[model samples]
Target chain A: MSGRLFHYNTLGTLMKGGFDGAFTFEEVLKNGGIGIGTVDHLDGELVILDHHGYRFDVTGQIHEVHLEDTTPYAAVIDFIPENKTTLNEKINKEILEEKMLGQFSSKNVFQAVKLHGRFSKIKCRSVQKQEKPYPDLVDVARDQAEFTAEDVTGTLVGIYTPALFGTISASGFHLHFISDDHHFGGHVLAFEINEPLITWQTIDTVEQKFPVGDPTFMKTDFDYSSVLEDIAEAE
Target chain B: MSGRLFHYNTLGTLMKGGFDGAFTFEEVLKNGGIGIGTVDHLDGELVILDHHGYRFDVTGQIHEVHLEDTTPYAAVIDFIPENKTTLNEKINKEILEEKMLGQFSSKNVFQAVKLHGRFSKIKCRSVQKQEKPYPDLVDVARDQAEFTAEDVTGTLVGIYTPALFGTISASGFHLHFISDDHHFGGHVLAFEINEPLITWQTIDTVEQKFPVGDPTFMKTDFDYSSVLEDIAEAE
Candidate 1:
């Protein structure tokens, strides 16, 4: 089976304040065709679909990600949808998540999900670029920019991480949105979907790549003691 | 660099009492040349060297692992030593770990280590085969068999996992030993190496595989809340 999820760096390292980006979009795309992440200095939310990367800046403007743009953390999968279903009724995030969980054969395996349709309302948030000596993520998130749109057509690109790997990646659903017109997109906070088409695949293997030689990543003493709590607060 | 580590299943799942093995040695050997793991039912300690798999049963008797033998948890790599050194002086586990850490370019990346030489004294342990209704690792470990030997020649097969991925795998040095004669071996508890040749490589990528359809693995609610503490106490 070609179900493999590729991720660079860890959420714990990002939460610990290591914001320098060493892996470029050029390299990240070679591993998978669809994914989500943040750009250099945590500049904005990143969304990858059809092997192309896009960045939703803090001002809620969408930009085609440059090949050379770097990222501190990201997860991508060469998605091959094993199951497809359509939701005819309006559904919220919590209800959708429960429905998705019910369809999963095992909650322990990672999953790649795609939701394409019109949303009655969707809320997103993106962080601004940071200066050197970056503050921890919880502090950076305090000043994040929030954006809300009504009746927008978009695709929610997401990865479902099991709780056992909460530190490496955000546990549960971590999704990013990119509208059809490519004018608006950011990290998805909450949404109400109407008759959306959902496609998902179980990821049997997770290939985690670390920032081996980056000076900032190497020097940083990553402490994950309160990482789960910090992630809950930050995201 | 072919510095990729392949592992089957998560330590958290094993600790949560999911003990039935679904992946076989035949499947595991295809991923790497050398590694360490446990056989079916958590029956014994397993060590792989030069592409050959061996099992150290609870009775301290070494057996050539059959190709069809299954494993619940294991980590393997196509080892190409990036650096090698000889320790002429006697060194204990703590001192050796310190020396190894100094040579590592990044503590965040996983590492594969091999030590071959004579040991003045070595202590090891292995668990007996468990029956149905498997108990948690902390409870099973209490009945583990301990083995000690003096002035023995052997190879210490080990993997170094970072603290950030502690729940997925055991953090720090997790080593298993096998004598040259293939007579004595088990999970290494403590050892005093004398003039041993040490070789290691940085694992930039870790490919983690899950037991997707296994009934027990699917049903078990893996709780990693106290996993780190439990690992510390069990080991």
Candidate 2:
């Protein structure tokens, strides 16, 4: 009923080490869409908008994503908010999620979420390129590096997928951050809002494209239960 | 490691009525593998083996599936037994699952199960094709036709997926049925097994192929929470 959105693949597949890029950044950014995902090779956190890709790596560095590059997973939609709301109240992540959920009519629809404001303190994390004989995702959480930024001004680009759709997407809000100054950002873990909330929404119509070319994604037969747990622990 | 499993699409997608078959019945049985799924248009239950696809319609009629027929969802792997054990005790479905799960080293991997024996009673259900704009899956659960066979001798073909993979796959066991005489079969709901049980297993290396051509599957954007509940209720 609202505007459109696109999803590339299931979160469960990505969490299971299906990390080869299935689509290019240019392909993902057609029509100037905004979204979040990990870069190919599981290198870092990715935020796409303004016809550019910003990568927040684990080494405390930000890099310009090449247009020719690719991604294994991403959800993007042309930014045309069908609904708008304002909540000028201080809140935490859980509270913010609840507030956004209040605006949704059903649990099955995907909602594109954008919040522009200042945060008290934001904590985020990213993982590096995993070497072969990749350990279980739970085992890799031990190595994830968490970054912190205090009094940060950023636009949290996120999507809210219902918990029942937890396989390829997260059960709830999944936001990736990019600061105003483009200095610090990562996969959002914890954050507190200041005030003057600005929110936007659009429904996503996703097309999941599998990576049949990658032998690993095509051939790996291992269990992802631990990986799911690892993702939960990291979250 | 011994063979491969072909997964047409996610169970989540199937519940959404993306019932157009993606692969042919003969393709699904190239190796004479066994599995469970729904026919195109959600017509009824489908169980394949010995290069023959069996259809169990809602009217309790059994038909031989043409090789050219396709399925929206199915998981099939070459039947190569990696392990075998005798289960010579009378037990209910729950008890049998618990006993077999104990043999697995982990909960994340797929477990293909086969059991041959007499059952005091078996209950199964098959859904008819839904009209569009298709109703929500939860709304249609009230209409599923439940069928029961008493003192039935049949073989149960099943797959056990991890709870973590709950979104696109059943979190636990999903079984389909075929009587010893090839007369009765459908999606298994419940059954009580007699003595001299038979079981088979082989790890499933599954590759999910999304339906890229189905515009509905590619474009639908909505939450599946109620649908998941509907599946639970039906199961």
Candidate 3:
């Protein structure tokens, strides 16, 4: 066939989720016209037979097959297998590192803030914890009290909030901030695991309601303008 | 937590070209809160914590877990685990059906054509002898022939092109007729698979090359206006 064939590990995981396991090679071959073969002897390799009688073996991949209608225009998407090496490599770690790095503050910001206690104990939680641990208020206040004379207009209130997920391994320190008394006012902010004072937002609270699942009786005041780009998953 | 998990097995052949496995569960938790107790686990089961924090175990007969990504998001997608299932379920069977169903005749058009003695025996090395036994020529012809009037527009020539696997599965067939005998005729006639008769110019001659590495390049010079809506697969 003149087309391509894609082989995807039926057992492979995906971002969407996992598989239910209701498919087989024999079932795949029920369709007439395409050839069926084995890849790595997996028992269900798809053999696409194009109009030109060329065969492509697609063992584990997703493929697009298009057949045009031209004399001598015989083509098929027999095999469009992808190289596995690229997939195995992790996504750019530097991107995550840079993001985390930007969330931290230099030795200068810490030197500038004055805390109530000289020593404050920090305890991280396990995945199995009941309630998510919150950052200590006294320490947060110190981190939130930074004042930079060099940058004339920046304020310290922009660096503290309740939405921060704490610091993660290899990533920098994480912090969150909310603006003023606007309960749902400014977008929730985040900072790196080790990098304090550098604020970012993972998600923006767009709408709010008194009770969950009561769509009809709800209150929607969160504008979500500040962190729109951060929470834009699709579109 | 409120959403249910469903699983089903293919009894006989369910030949709709694809299957969806949906499972459901009752009110284990409500409104993103924890609920239900620990249940004994088993192999090959999928556990998902819903918005309400109720756990669901989804199991399948033939498929297995491939991958899983969970956020506090609303819905979930379980991709088929095995290569054959993903290929057939997600790619091959689905795309093939879409392409064929979109453009080709709903009812096999070969049934309408009056063929001479034992046209079924007219086998070529281009097609797979094992997959398709002779009698299905009606479906084959229907998938490959263009509609033509009995009037003497020109000569009818049958062209045989091999698919990628040295089979007739993805090949194209066309018939051409010349109004005036000339090496470079401006206007002539041609018919192809799933197409009607049409006049063409010199450049429109059935001599176009396959685009890049496209294996399924059977472009024909017949009228596709009627079936264009039914056969377009870009979506």
Ranking of predictions according to TM-score: 1, 2, 3
Please list the residue runs of candidate 2 whose C-alpha ends up more than 4 Å from where it truly belongs after superposition: A1-165, A168-235, B1-3, B202-204
* Model 1 regions more than 4 Å off: none
lDDT of each residue in B1-235, candidate 2, tens digit only: 3335566666776766667776677767784477788777777888876557787888878877788987877777666666667777777778878887777544555677777778888888877876667665445557878899988888888788765556667778888899988777788878887674556664534544455445565456745656556557655
State which candidate has the highest TM-score: 1
What DockQ would you assign to candidate 2? 0.09
Candidates sorted by lDDT, best first: 1, 2, 3
Poorest 10 consecutive residues of model 2 chain A by lDDT? Answer: A204-213
lDDT of 2 by residue, A113-133 (tens): 777778888988887876665
Give every candidate's TM-score on chain A. 0.97, 0.90, 0.14
Q: Highest DockQ: give the candidate number.
A: 1
Model 1 lDDT per residue over A1-235, tens place: 2389998888889898878887998999887688999888888999999999999889988888888989999999989999888877889888788889887766788999998898999999999898888888988889999999999998999999899998888899999999999987899989998777899998888989888868778756777789988888887
Candidate 1 falls in which docking quality class?
medium
Recovery fraction of native interface contacts for candidate 1: 0.77
Docking class of 2: incorrect
Q: Write the per-residue lDDT of candidate 3 for residues A107-155, one digit (tens) a residue.
A: 1011011011111111111011011132221222232212111111111
Each model's TM-score, in the order given?
Answer: 0.97, 0.58, 0.15
- Model 1 achieves a DockQ score of 0.71
